[model samples]
Target: MNILVMMKVTFSTEEEITIEQGEIVQEGISLILNPYDEYALEQAVQVKEVYGGEVTVLSVGPKRYEDTLRTALAMGADRMVLIDDPALMGDEWIVSQAISAFAKKERFDLIFGGQMSIDYASAQMGPRVAVELGIPIVTTILEFTMDGQCAVVHRDMDGYMEKLRVPLPALFTTQQGLNEPRYPTLQNRMRARKKPIVYYIGEDLDFSHEDRQVKTVSQEFFVAPRRSEGKILHGSLADQVKELCDFLRFAIQ
Candidate 1:
């Protein structure tokens, strides 16, 4: 089983992120692997433990992202790939296009991703990548297993727990409930420090800055969305209830 774990670099906060000339500002901020993707990688490590295979951590980002991928290697991935290219900054679909293109070349057996990235929280990248590759995919999965030549995925739909079995060579977007991610032990970190990384770049990969070019650009960079002040209505319970009701009625009216 050749497992490809797709991860991403994302900011830690939910707000209007500062962009210096269309690129994310990173002066004093820390960039971490999307937590959901961390869970996906941890799960991939576990799968390798059971199935006897290699875990290849893949991320499409700038050259600086190698540090994060090295961290993933420290955690336990057998190998890593960084699809470093400036044009990947276009849009999510472009990033997906680049990854799916790379995946096609590898003939990997399984692809995994987190339910969503922290910053966007749109939960679109994984499915989009799968679409680009024309592979079957299941999202928001809580757990999964190999059953013969199929994958049995468990997920929560509404309030009910549901299980679906799909064939191999599929994509899965893992939810936080999947499994607790493993913290890299000292020994693992030491080993990861020396692991060789295979860098994937623009020259060899067959992808263009064209094709659904989002034409997306930011006008300016800002901080967290401005918040409004809340007024507190304080008084006796009965009086407060009446006041709140009066305020609502007045506002609505």
Candidate 2:
């Protein structure tokens, strides 16, 4: 089996949010493999253990993202493919296109990724890549089972469970409850440092001009205004009601 795991590197959870020039400043901030994507990596590793196959992790980010890919390799993934180029950064559509382009050159029985990137939470990449590959997609999978070329998946829709069966060469976006991600051991971490990481630039992929463009543009970003403390109503119920009514009237005005 050939499994490909799509992952993202994002700011560490403890990092403070800092905005600059209408964009989040990442300089000097600690980055790690996206927590949600870790689940996909864990699942891929588990699948590889059971089926005895190669697992490859793919990511689109700067060279720093190699740390994230290394961590995945330490967790038991076989190889890493990195599309490292700042010019390739765009919205979900563009990212998925690049992934699809590279993926078309290789054969994969399964592709996995997080349900949504923690940074954007657009929940579009997996579906978009599925469209580009003309394959079926199962999002937010809670239970996964495979038998030969067929996969049985169970997902949560609202509060109900939905079961589905899809053929090989399918894509899946993992949700939080799917599995517990394993931490990379020190031994594996050291070994991963020696693993080779294949790199590619934007020009390497065949993408149209429109596919490379970012669809959404941010106008501005500012911290939300501080909220005022609640006022204490000290008096009889009638008096308090009267004060509340007056406050409401003033607020509406």
Show model 1 residue runs off by greater than 4 Å: 14-24, 208-212, 215-226
In terms of lDDT, the best-performing candidate is 2
Query: What are the models' TM-scores?
Result: 0.90, 0.91
Clashing pairs in 2: none
Model 2 lDDT tens row, 1-253: 8999999999887988889888888889988888878888899898889988999999998887787679999998999999987767777767888899899989999999999878778889899999999998999998898977988999999999999999998999998999999989999999999999999987888767776887776687776677999899989999999999999999999
lDDT of 1 by residue, 133-179 (tens): 88899998998899987899999999999999999889999988899
Strongest candidate by TM-score: 2
Tell me how candidate 2 scores on lDDT: 0.89
Candidate 2: segments with Cα more than 4 A from true spot: 208-210, 230-253
